[model samples]
Target: MKVIGVTAPSTGSGKTSVSLALLSSLNNSVSVKVGPDYIDGSLGSAVSGKPAHNLDRWIQGRDFMRRFRWLSSVYDFAVVEGVMGMYDSGSPVNLSTDYYFRKIGIPYILVIDVSKLAESAYYIAKGFIGRNCIGVVINNFYSEKHLIIVRKAFSDHGVPIIGEIPHAEELKIPERHLGLKTAGEMPDIREKAVHFSQFIDFSFIDKLKDIPLIPEDRKPLLVGGGNIYVAYDNAFNFYYGESLDFLGRIGKLHYFSPLKGEIPENPHMIYLGGGYPELYASKLAEKSHLNHALKTYSDQGVPILAECGGLMYLESTFESKESSLKFPGIFGGSVKMTGKLTLGYTKLNVLKDNLLFRRGEVVYGHEYHYSDIEDSWEKTMQNVLGKGIQGYDGLYSMNTQGSYSHFDLMRYGKRLSGSIAKFMR
Candidate 1:
């Protein structure tokens, strides 16, 4: 599909606003995503009424990542919201959002916050934009003079300022440390989307008409049969649109919520992307039915991939600041919230060719979580702990892999699906 990336300097820079305006403005749109994402999928689907896929490069492998690249032939357009700052999304410089732009070669629509500066906004935009830039959206403009300055910034960069969204009357509410609280978490989020779209130049789609179509050779691998159930809900929410769309390209992908119900039935594969499972540990624990369902399937050798909270859930127990509770007990360890912060960019130097990752392959991605091993519970997970680049910790495991690595599925490269498709087929 014709994909364009939506990016910003840091959180709350109107990436979602620009994304929504574009989704609402276009038809049959999807979102490629990154980070411990939830809000983008929530809002993107709200605007388009389609299930958005999580295309996180960090958490999975290439085969799973591009499972749906051929979607361009199925949908009108695809919009990808960048992970952290363009370059800051990963643990190092190369793994940044800017790096992903070049990796995927998707043209970008740079969203600049005109709050602190007007004409200087161009520099902020210039700093974020790499060579693949296609357009711009000047969000949070204050006055007529501000618009002139922002317009000039785009003109100088040769990047069209698609929309100069004004200081949204709705965005002024307080935010938590993670980022803007979800619109679903807040009732006014819908109104905010509607109100924010007013400021965006909705007609930017017209300019993209000349943007060339992606060649068939580069499309994601396609599949016509077999079951692949992905976790899509308030919890287990870390997903990218491109990744999921790509998955749907190759399998009969279905979604089941870990938040509200049981995992979908009799699936051959399960994908659990990232999300704040720590927030709902007790409730998720209460879903003994679904928990056991996954536990049984994992035990039965259904190929499964879970990241972040999904990884946490597979453990024996989940402990966050809220409360500690029993987990599905599928993996080999107990996860307890660490008093010290446990978060950063990580490079997974592949140890061996296993079910998912290859031997000696290094993957780039980020890790952000407040949990760690409990000193009291060390013996249960003592053998499983891993640390640093190659995860030299040499920890333990079941058939499943649970890690803070958070690498992308797409970058596992073509060997990703090529290798795994045989097992499922």
Candidate 2:
């Protein structure tokens, strides 16, 4: 498989442009998002008209190397958009995109915010360069002179000037909490893409024609012929395309929806990914029967893995389109929307052994949540659960696992894969 990595000096610089232009310029390429970023994933997926897979070492695991290999199996080219910086701003932790990139031996496109610095652009790019770095894309350029000098600096290093994208007032992505406003919130996101597409040089997309996509080896690392139920409904839809494909190697996939149809028959696992459950709370509550089925599945010891919005659905209530709505209350908590934004990257360690991940094993992940679930005296004591480990504090908490960390599956290679494998057992 041909793979290209897009990274920048900092967040919101213009790696999106590099990714969009490149992926759009590819031939049926698959997009893989690194870190716990969702906006870039949504944008990249839309660019290729394919589901983008998230490979976050924190959310996924260290041993998940095989999962990455498994994910890009059939794709001709894979574009991985990096998180914050190429190297960890803090520590050399598990699930970092850079860690995964070096592990997978994939080349990348360095995008630097050259709005201020001229030759320094080349310096930042050089500092973060690797054997995997293909070239540099100078993004968010402010002046033509700066662009010229910046281009020349890279030229001096023999680095190809892939493309230079100027800053535009219109292309700003809307944000709330930690992640971009749920893709659903901005119905006009397509317009933004179209606008960016106009100014973005699509030639870079074509330049990647011969780039190699790293391929995956499908070996049975998990239990045999596993039955995996992937969540795909509007309520819980932040699942990684590659995650499912990787899991598919060891099992049969049965997709069940709480907003659309019935749950699949007797499956070994129930997968609930992340999404805006608050946006579809009414619909989720309407499907009381489905909720009951989920509760039954959980009671019967069917492995259920949920994250963010998926976790919210498992709770008792969430405010939505209709009045206050009630759900399965499988884990028993009240999910409420908050005007305050709670979002950022995190390092979560598994405190207790569970189906997914091992104790003290670290996973590099992110959490962007706009809702709050307060602990009640009765529920906390009765369930012996403390808001079920999520967000930043409880990010690395215990069993039948999940969190608000909307990270890419690639980041948490081994740890995430092994952890999830435990649930299948």
Per-structure clash totals for the candidates:
32, 45
The lDDT, on a scale of 0 to 1, for candidate 1 is 0.64
Candidate 2 yields a Cα-based lDDT of 0.65
Candidate 1 per-residue lDDT over residues 1-425, each given as its tens digit: 56778888876787877777677766787655655465566667767667775654445545433434555655778888887666675343344667656766777877877878877888777777766776778877788887897788679767777677777565654455445555456665555666666766655555554234443444556653567788876666665555565566667778888888666786766777767777778888898988888888777666677766777787777765666687878765667755555566555555555445556655655565666643221111111223421243212243355555454554442443543365465
Instruction: Judge candidate 1 at residue 235 and give its lDDT.
Output: 67
Task: Flag regions of model 2 displaced more than 4 Å.
Answer: 49-51, 54-61, 64-73, 91-107, 112-135, 138-160, 166-174, 181-216, 220-227, 261-268, 319-324, 338-366, 375-425
Writing each residue's lDDT as its tens digit, candidate 2 over 1-425 gives 66788887677677776676666667778778776566678767766788777765555655456556765676778888887777754434554557777876777777888777878888877877776677777777878876888888889888876666777666677665445664545666556656555654545545554434456665555545657788775566676666665567656877777778477686776778877777777777888778888878777667677777876777777765447788877755677887767655555555555555556656455556678864331211011112233323222222344455544533333344444455566
Q: lDDT at 305 for candidate 2?
A: 71
Candidate with maximal TM-score: 1
